[model samples]
Target: MPASSHRPSPASPLEDDNLLPQILLRLPPDPSSLPRASLACTRWRDHVANPGFRRRFRLHHRRNPPLLGFFDGCGSLDFHPTLEAPERFSLKRDEGDGVRRPLGCRHGLVLLLVPKPLQVIVWDPVTGDQHRLDVPQGLTMNECYESVINGAVLRAAAGDAEHFKVVMVAADGDGVENRRAVACVYSSETGAWGGFVTAPIPYDADAHASGLFWRFSTSIYIDHAMLAGDSLYWQLIGNFEGILQFDLERQSLSVMSVPVPIYSKGNCFKLMRAEGGGGIGFLLMSNSDYIAQLWRRKTDSDGVA
Candidate 1:
């Protein structure tokens, strides 16, 4: 203990450089894009790729928590790391009852659907960049059929941040609508919703009905480019039989089957975003309690599920 040195003046009581660690716990690592985020990369891969991030991202989204929008009705939007409780920033509705439709998360923007307007609204929630899109018009609505249909919006694939796709399934339409349930893919980059990819009916019934009661189940991000090898996966309600998968590379839809003994009856309980990134997951709803089941897209299933 030299008098001159004096142990660096007893560490100066507050000469703290360890503040970085404490701050880190409060500030999450930089998040990667939805697709490539799960895969390893040099872009803060270790931190942004945390499974915790994946889980939080999914839960917050699946359970957006209904918020009374600036309209007659209300629904909640995802809480982006940048904007927590985005429902607070939700823009007012112009005409619809604000039937909240959690389309999908793309480029930090939450895609929503106003059931009454039959329109799609792209919400920034953070910047509150609200854009409403009237569902094309002229093309007959799915309600024309007695079958059943669901509309979902999803961010395309990697490197296509500027684009988003809306997939609508009008299962078993009467007259010409049978098996004619076309998948309408809307590209924001293209600024239009075009093409009829034909959504194969996984269930003969309304798929969303649970025990005579109409239950609205959301499609959970099952797996990302990681599992699809290039496509994104989503788990829909109606007996967890299969997942509706969209191929970002080719822009197509196929079914991802469930493993044996799992028997996804089609009633997927809770939808969770995958921790591995890229996609989301599902929670099995049971009377006893909520149990979770997991799966990834198998390149071999080929829509059989």
Candidate 2:
């Protein structure tokens, strides 16, 4: 210790301003703990709130949870506590039930399907805000068939909460040989439905049953979509066995096959959005072997995963 007679030693490097952020970056990935750490001081709060810090924090964790929230695959909506994501909060529906099911979820918004007159509701589980838009008219209203078709949420732009788009690949008719599909887009900004974009179905739609019991198991939409850049990917029905990609920017549709050669019965496949590279990844899990295989897309290559 020194009292003016002698010079005090320089403060430790830990006390330096630069060292604070480096310490905060080491915070556990559990987002619930971050606010508690921020309570320590305003400086800690600033560090924790930084966007860069949040990105780095996600990458730091080895086994970061994949699901933010999920559709219960039945006719209800709830959060999975074990797989809960602190960044995106859970929602509770107040509307009296009359066949409400989760259609799609993306970018903090969830698409829900409600029948009787046929409608799709866009909901933000975090803020408890929602916008309801009627499904396009002149299309097939078979609730059993429509629920299985693919739908997706497209953000208007990153960090723009006021606008987003809800798109659906709906069935034009339920014919057997030449099944046709139509796409409808709903813009939150315009608050109206867009014109239907039509296309030819590759495979037979009648191969799968169309009943309430079959509705849960089968659909033209194989699984929830994987968003990469401006495109959204959805796995196809069993007969087709491929992925349907919709380019939000171009407003076009293209089909691609699964990486596997022969589609096995009861095999599980998932399309995932790459964490860092902004590319896409496909996860395959076959019942034959319990091993899970993950393949990432190669941007430079012409056709590789």
TM-score, every prediction: 0.50, 0.63
**Model 2, global lDDT:** 0.64
Q: Give the range of the ten consecutive residues with the poorest summed lDDT in model 2.
A: 210-219
Best by TM-score: 2
Question: What are the runs in model 2 whose C-alpha is more than 4 Å off?
Answer: 1-73, 81-96, 139-145, 171-174, 204-219, 259-262, 274-277, 296-305
What number of clashing residue pairs does each candidate have, in the order they appear? 13, 0
Residue-wise C-alpha lDDT for candidate 1, range 1-305, written one tens digit per residue: 76674444544424432342233333322232443443544433444455654444434443232332332222744343333422345466675455565544544566566677576677755445676776654234334321133455555654343455655543333332133234556677777877666455343253333232213222223222223245445543333345666665676766544443222344344434555643545545444445555643223356532
lDDT tens string, model 2, 85-141? 445454555466466767667665788877644667788664467777777765544
C-alpha lDDT of residue 291 in model 1: 56
